[model samples]
Target: MTGWIESDRWAERARELRDEGWMLMDLCGLDRSGLGRSVVNAGGAGTAGAGFRNAEGTGGLYGPRFEVVVQLLHALKKERMTLHVNAAGDPPTVPSVVEVWPTANFLEREAFDMFGIQFEGHPHLTRILMPDDWEGHPLRKDYGVGKVPVEFISQPLMQIDSPGQSPETVAAERSVDELGQSGPPLRTVEEG
Candidate 1:
């Protein structure tokens, strides 16, 4: 089962589902800014819009720029449910389910780190994958693509003087026979 819940009622609905024995399976964010080229229908069929509609039946041509998807599972009943909550505003904001599900802490942080979707009431909403100094969310459609030079740790170069130690110096002072052929020797069919 799948349903779209309003952003304001996100936490409340999540709590209700939790109380009903639904286990929070996964939580992630989506950036709908690029949906103009490809359409995504969240509310299944019968909707008149290109995107999905919330529980209150509110949705536009493309809905909100950001949305949070929550997956829940009822283990004993063998049932699964997907919930979509639209995040609105300059920095898309959605109610955090971390309080209801402790596992949501890292998932919500990742959404914030990659898509810049702010999870309101998140106890510690910090960057999980990117460095603290990262300027913008890399997964957002509007974020600029820029190259970042990777600085590797400096290490002392080892001096390899023995033959075969390096590819450039392989068998430098030895004949092919001295090197010795690797693997089993080739035999004719008659020998076998």
Candidate 2:
């Protein structure tokens, strides 16, 4: 089963789960900013997973906005539990669980990198996929899909404009000499 907890009580709930012999399985964040449609549908239970589904069949598995989700496994009991924490903030801040499960370090970093959610009390919260200088969080629904324009420089051997022309014409146009070095211009195809 999945239980929803407030952001302030996140760490405490995690500790409780740990005391119950639940090992942290996974940790991540969710962005529900612009999900134009409701999570529930005629398909029965909507997008809510087994754990997030409310008894009232509401919209989501967690809060209406951002959420930090954790999966726990009970090896001896052969069972799993999902925990949800509502990250309510402009930038969405949640408590760090690294102290509870050291494995959360990398997983939380990845969540922050992709979603721009902040983990309070984290030893180091930084980008894991994008460069440090990257501008925006890529996974956020409101994040723009920025495009980088690329320019290609052509070399004599790699020139693409000589599709129908002979290599000799290409070499001449590029002023490449017999030694494949730039030298005096050679006769053009028409000149020859």
Candidate 3:
């Protein structure tokens, strides 16, 4: 096992890329000063294992500007890094780097789905995961995933699941009995 020091830990890995002109754009994260331990030293830029995977496990801090985002996407695509934009957490929006990095295309959308962060300047931005009618950004910091209220007093769980209908429909079909309770309850699961 090779334990490493902070200052030098990822310096070498980022050296070549940085040398090629990538600014150590905000060594940002919750771990580093203002960024908190949120970002992983900025080296996680455009790969499968990058950015702050919110400690709360609900959201994360993806630091990137429109220009940088586009650039990063382009580089990642050339290198074939699977890209996905994930900003469902609070302040749900990651900069549109697609202008600079063409690869950020679908990745940004995925980020939108997983994190709820909107990508401005994208040719077209729409729901890639949830349906367009999805009430809330499921991955957003403010997303509420609780099951809608129903009548344990009425149909009961066992009765709700009949025929080809999913349990959810049983509740929706009788939303009148479950008024004021359309979307599921929001859980304070993640905080940055």
Candidate 3, superposed: residue stretches over 4 Å from native? 1-91, 141-144, 148-192
True-vs-predicted CA distance for residue 97, candidate 2, Å:
0.8
Per-residue alpha-carbon lDDT of model 3 for 36-142, expressed as tens digits?
Answer: 43433233334344445553553432433211121222343343221122333344444454554355566656655555556666776676777777665554334
TM-score-wise, the better of 2 and 3 is 2
Model 3 TM-score (2 dp): 0.36
Tell me model 2's lDDT, rounded to 2 decimals: 0.74
**Cα lDDT of model 2 by residue, 1-192, tens digit:** 655678998898788888999898888888866644233122221234433233256534345577777778899998877766778887889999999889999999999999888999899998998999988788877776654443453334535463687766665566654444554465657853
lDDT (Cα) of model 1: 0.74
Clashing pairs in 2: none
Please report how far candidate 3 places residue 170 from its true position, in Å.
Answer: 25
Which candidate comes out best when scored by lDDT? 1
Q: For residue 177, give model 2's deviation from the true position in Å.
A: 36
- Looking at candidate 3, the ten consecutive residues that score lowest on lDDT are 1-10
* CA lDDT of every candidate: 0.74, 0.74, 0.41
